[model samples]
Target: MKTLRKYLSAEGLIKSIYSKFKKIQDPKNRTGKISLTDCLMSCFAIFSLKGLLQAEE
Candidate 1:
């Protein structure tokens, strides 16, 4: 059996979570070029990777 954390951390599962997160209102004034979706994706990536995101796969 898969652990809950493993199930939740799956790539497909993360994509689904991102889709839902995209609909939420952004606090930023939508000023800079960086989009809210990009911001959220970055945050999620950093969080899911435990802040050790790297370039090489």
Candidate 2:
């Protein structure tokens, strides 16, 4: 439990969550066929992963 808490804090999980919401609120690319929300969510996840990588440094 301690290790989990440490990981979450050190990794900035809260910032990542907010970033996900921000992405959802933005517009998508020129193609409107795909769901913007879905695309944004995926992008947010990838961004969060990158953030985690940076945080680990």
Candidate 3:
């Protein structure tokens, strides 16, 4: 049950981060304009999800 709760939390957090990523829009911004903060956040989220998957296994 604890593992299930952790998995759900991680999933929800990842989904929220992805939603925020999708919302980023700047017509004048170039590919180089990607926010470093967002990039780091996404990396962290991916790592967290990977850890959670390993835990489940």
- TM-score for each model: 0.56, 0.31, 0.36
Each candidate's lDDT (Cα)? 0.74, 0.59, 0.64
- The per-residue C-alpha lDDT of model 2 at residue 57 equals 73
- Any residue pairs clashing in model 1, and if so which? none
Where in model 1 is the C-alpha error above 4 Å?
Answer: 1-9, 51-57
lDDT of 1 by residue, 1-57 (tens): 654564556766887878888898887668889878888888888766753566433
- For candidate 3, lDDT tens digit of each residue in 1-57? 344453357666666676676686755565686575477575665566677557656
- In order of listing, the candidates' clash counts read 0, 0, 0
- Identify the superior model by lDDT, candidate 2 or candidate 3: 3
Ordering by lDDT: 1, 3, 2
Ranking by TM-score: 1, 3, 2
Tens digits of lDDT, candidate 2, 1-57 = 344453358456755665556566444344566565566656666675687657657
Residue 46, candidate 3: alpha-carbon lDDT: 57
Off by over 4 Å in 2: 1-33, 50-57
Superposed by TM-score, candidate 2 places the C-alpha of residue 40 at a distance from the truth, in angstroms, of: 0.4
